[model samples]
Target: MNRTLIPLAMALILCLLAATAPAADSHPGWFGVIADPGALTIRNGVAGRLSEYTVAIGDPVRPGQIVARIDPEQAAAQLAQMQAQIDAAEAELEGKKATTNSLQERLERILTRPDALSSGALAEMRGNLRTARAETRAAEARLAQQIQERELTRGKIAKTELRSPIQGHVVEYLANVGADLSTDAAVVRLRSAQPLVLRFAFDPRDAAAPSVGTRIRVQEDRSIGAPGNDTRSHTATVESLAMIVDEDSG
Candidate 1:
């Protein structure tokens, strides 16, 4: 009985020592890092001299707002030339179609009175009708192609207007009025107003502390000229946690 009591007393002392041990350090402070870039460059899709520039630096812009315009004179002139060609093709097609109709009528009349016309003359008239029909078809196709080209020119003219792709403040003007810009040339830079995401890196030893859904406090750097020039604090939640430790940082 005395030996059993001694073992029990030693086990109770070991349990008390284990309970008094210090826990792992879990620091909630994380350095500032943006998950998404704050600025985006807006570019034009067409190449031309800028005719109109509407936005300046520090101006607020919304999505689909027209901020710049390229000169549409060249594209518009191309469309006009194509339209004239299409008109001429249509007129020529009309003439060919009228000739085809006349030949068809003559062939029908001759067919009705076969005894009045020689076989050779009827064959020549049929061939002429076929030729007129072919000419008309060719003219129609040419007019269709010209119309398609006109539509493409009009589309190019439409693309001359550069619009903002996001809601943000215009940070810089990459191109000014009368500036020649190539296709995909940047027109303006904008800084988004979306909420910033914070990234925190911690030692792998304390990784168990910042699991998903953990609450954290972030202190903002005070700006010198900002209103009240006060330091701001923001509460952020741990949305995600990286399981793997970064070799260089950890």
Candidate 2:
């Protein structure tokens, strides 16, 4: 009975030691800085001398807002030339129309007395009538072409002004006033401010568990002894996960 009791006591002591043994230590997940999840680019939409600049770096701008204006003197001069051409064509067209109307009236009068009209006189009037009609048609075509040219000139003039394409803050200014800019030249950079997002990379193993829209916490500063540094924690949604792990970091 004593031997059996000794074996039972030994087994109990072994169980206590196993239960008290410390668990293995694990490393906490390393984190990276968070930032907005979009890119910005500065571009010019028109070609002309940059006459005015209304924005600078770090200035906030709204979509469809005008950021700068180009020198409109050249464009205005072209528009004026087109307008003059249109006016001249219209005046010529009016004269041709009047001439055609007078010729038609004369033809009507002669047709009423066709029997009394001399062959030479009637033939001359008919020839003049044909010429007037032809002139009128030519004038009509010229007027149409001039009108189109005028409109095109006005459109080009409007293009001299530069407007913002998105609601964002100006991150950079690439051009200055008095600079001659060509079409598609870089002018200013825009970065979206609303619905801002933060992005950071994580271990592929941990990233697997987070799918799209998964809630996560983002820390601004990660320094030792900074207990209140995490107060600015932002809740972010997972946008995407890389399929390939970075070899160097892994």
Task: Point to the candidate with the largest TM-score.
Answer: 1
Q: lDDT per residue, candidate 2, 117-145, as tens digits?
A: 89998899899989999999999998898
C-alpha lDDT of all candidate models, in order: 0.72, 0.66
Q: How accurate is candidate 2 locally (lDDT)?
A: 0.66
Q: Flag regions of model 2 displaced more than 4 Å.
A: 1-45, 194-238, 242-250
Return the top candidate by lDDT: 1
For candidate 1, give the lDDT: 0.72
Cα displacement (Å) at residue 241, model 1 = 3.0
TM-score of each: 0.69, 0.64
